[model samples]
Target: MTPLLRNIVANYTSQLYVILIGLAVVPQYIKYMGIEAYGVIGFFAMLQSWMSLLDLGLSPTLGREASKLKAGVTRAGVLKLFLRFLETLFSFTALVVVALSWILGPWIASSWLKLESLSPSDVALCVVLVACIISLRLLSGIYRGGLLGMERQVVANVIAVIAATLKSLAVLPLLIWVTHSILAFFLFQLVGAIVEIVLMRIAFVKALPSVATEKFQWNLLREPLRFGVGLAFLSGVWIVISQSDKLILSHILSMQNFGEFMLATSVAWGAYSLISPLQQAVLPRLVVFFEQNQHDKFVLLYRQTTMLMAAILAGVAGTMAAYPEHVLFAWTGNLTVAARAADILRWYVSGSGFMALAGMAYVLQHARGDVRMHIRGNLLNVFILIPSTIALTLKFGAIGAAITWAVTNLFFLIFWTRIVHKKFLPEIANSWLTRDISPALLVGALLCVAAHQLNWPVSSRLLSFAGLAVLVVATTGFLLFIQAETRRIMSFFLRGIVKILCTKNV
Candidate 1:
């Protein structure tokens, strides 16, 4: 397989594995900790996103810096640059984590998070534990971006698979055998975070050996810092866009209801997972292409990747929209939770699909180092999204939060995309819609409508899961392979697979 496609597949494999592990663990976690405790865990999930605001765009900037090496920087030069970058990032992230944990942790545990079963002390301890986990993660995140810049995704994903397994699957035993507390759960994650950092260090050394021997210098960071400021704000804006609804819903709904919402959010994110790997795989290459002033190649890669990504995302989103209740019940084994979240999941997942498309546009802008469009778009969301979320939640409750999320994304899909295309690549403005989006939407909507109308009996959970799985495959395959361009790419991909198998056989 081509290196880009290979990286995408490997990354997707790792992500899918993590999703499955989390799916398996959720029921056990809810059973052990109960929904309120699990909701606290969900709140921690939101806190992780909040904590990422401290990243200051350092990690992605690191990736962008490393990708510049493709322009022919020496190993020593690259290592010097990287070490300087990491030093600044690690030091700043560490201090922020300490400050945030010390100041905000107590407030969040005591006042912010709405708790029911867990005591204030217990909740406080969990907050502190999550702080530590996020701190370690913040420290280690640069290597992940570094690996992406190096195009070392296969090795990166191997390390990620190991880390994902330890953080997720290992938690079940920790909860069952060790302690049935959220504090204990997060403590285990802290340990996993440390180990992940260590493995990332090893992977970095292996992937870029000279980096291990180089001395650090602060000078290399000056350029990246200037670039990173915009990126950092962009990251924060997105985190706000993503987490604002959940934050509002947390206040409006009870802890148990919020937990149900969180569950559905998790599933929506899993669908979005289909887009992320492809985005990461394309980004370094896009940067290199832009740097080389190859606009045609850049546009081609952008369009092709968007088509493939949108098609895949459409299928995943369609399935969730079509079978939210069945899928949730099958995954969580709580019909009440499933029932509560089913409607929200449909709206949220549909929005996620649109968000995935917008993500591609955002990535293109980032690759070009043109953050103006994205910044403006996010600013618009801040003004519109936050107020709308608050009003909707106050008036209509949790479902309103979901609707607001969907509407905000749909708005971005039309508005931000037009601005991005107009500013960057006006030529494909009409073609992108005609070729990539409209057809996929038509197919996805039809699949959702048809699948929902089917009289599939939910007599057995396994049967329901199997039926939904078929629908997912059918939807994804129909959209993904329907277009002539995508079909051609698939044939090439298949040929690559065949070539690999033949070589192995020899």
Candidate 2:
């Protein structure tokens, strides 16, 4: 299989595992540890994301550099040397971040957090453990980048599946035999990180054994660092855009509400996770495409992928929005949480779905190594989002925060599309709105309406959800892929498969 197809396959396989495991585990976590501990867990999850800022964009930049090496634009020796240098830089950075988190743990537990059940000491221990886990995860990004650069996605994802299984299932044993300790919860995650690091290191070594002899040089860092600076800034801003809502909500909402909102946020962002395989698989190739001056192919790719993403997200997000209570209840078996987060989930997923669709445009920008537009867009979000979210949340609570997110993404989508057309791909400017985004919006909205009318009781949830799934697939397929050209392509593939089957039968 092609690298892109392999990467997508591997990524989807990993995500499917994570989703299934998460569905099974979330209810157990809530059942055993209570909502208060789940809040702490959510805090750790948030910090894990925030820790990406420490990467300084090296992971992505490394992928680009690795792709260049594979394409013969850079020497393997140079790439190997640079990888060692990055390891040194990342090690030092991880130490500093971990130390800082450790020092600040007490202050966060005492001042910022509002947990009623857990002691400050226990919270502190959880914080420190989470810090360690985040540090290890951040450091692991280097190896992950190395693997992806080598197009070892299948190997990388297999390791991830094993690590995730170990982490997600860790709490069950802890809750059963050991105490239902939050510290133990994070301890398991830390163990998973250790396992992931060992496996990732093996994968990297196996992919590039020449790195063993490659000397680390300070001078080798200059070029990648220069390219990485913009990316680092963009990453910092993007993190702020994505996480600022939850950070703000943590203080404003009660612990129980915050936990519920976090759950809703998790479900919403899961939409992004579903679409990420496309983005990850496409990034390395964007560089190659640009270098070869394949503008026509690039635009075609942009349109096709955007349409595909929009169709899929629309269906998923729309269904989630339309039947959030049902979906959440099914996932958690907690009617209280389902009721509390229903509207928030609806708004958050709907917005996140669109943002994920626009992420394709961001991928194109990142691949072209022109991050100024993304930086500008994210800056706009920071300036507009924080105040708007705070005001709306004060007036309307968690749902307001959800609305603020959705609105911000709407504006960003418009801004991103304008820039993409004006500065990047003007050829499709006229048709983009009508041909691309509009159809996606229509499909999503129509499906959401269709789902809303179904009103199936929770008792029949399996059949109801099954019906929803059928609606999603049928709607998305007809709108996105049932065109004349797509039909022809499908027919050709079907004929090829049939011929192979007939030959085997003979």
Q: Give the winner by TM-score.
A: 1
Backbone steric clashes in candidate 2, count: 0
The lDDT per prediction is 0.81, 0.78
**Could you say which candidate leads in lDDT?**
1
What TM-score, computed on C-alpha atoms, does each candidate reach? 0.95, 0.93
Residue 10 deviation, candidate 1, in Å? 1.1
Q: Give the TM-score of candidate 2.
A: 0.93
In angstroms, the error of model 1 at 196 is: 0.5
Output the worst ten-in-a-row residue range by lDDT, candidate 2.
Answer: 482-491
State the lDDT of candidate 1 residue by residue for 1-506, as single tens digits: 77889888888888788778887888898988888887888888997898898888888887887788764543546554665556676777677676667666667766877777788887777767787788778867888888888888888888888888888888888788878888788888888899998888778666665534445555655677777889999989989888987877777666887788899999988898877888888898999899889999999889888898878877778878878888898898777788888998988898898888887778889889878778988899899988988888788887887888888888888667877887798998777766778777777788778866787655667887888888778877787677887889888888998999999999
lDDT value, candidate 2, whole model:
0.78
Model 1: residues >4 Å from true position, as ranges? 73-79, 209-220
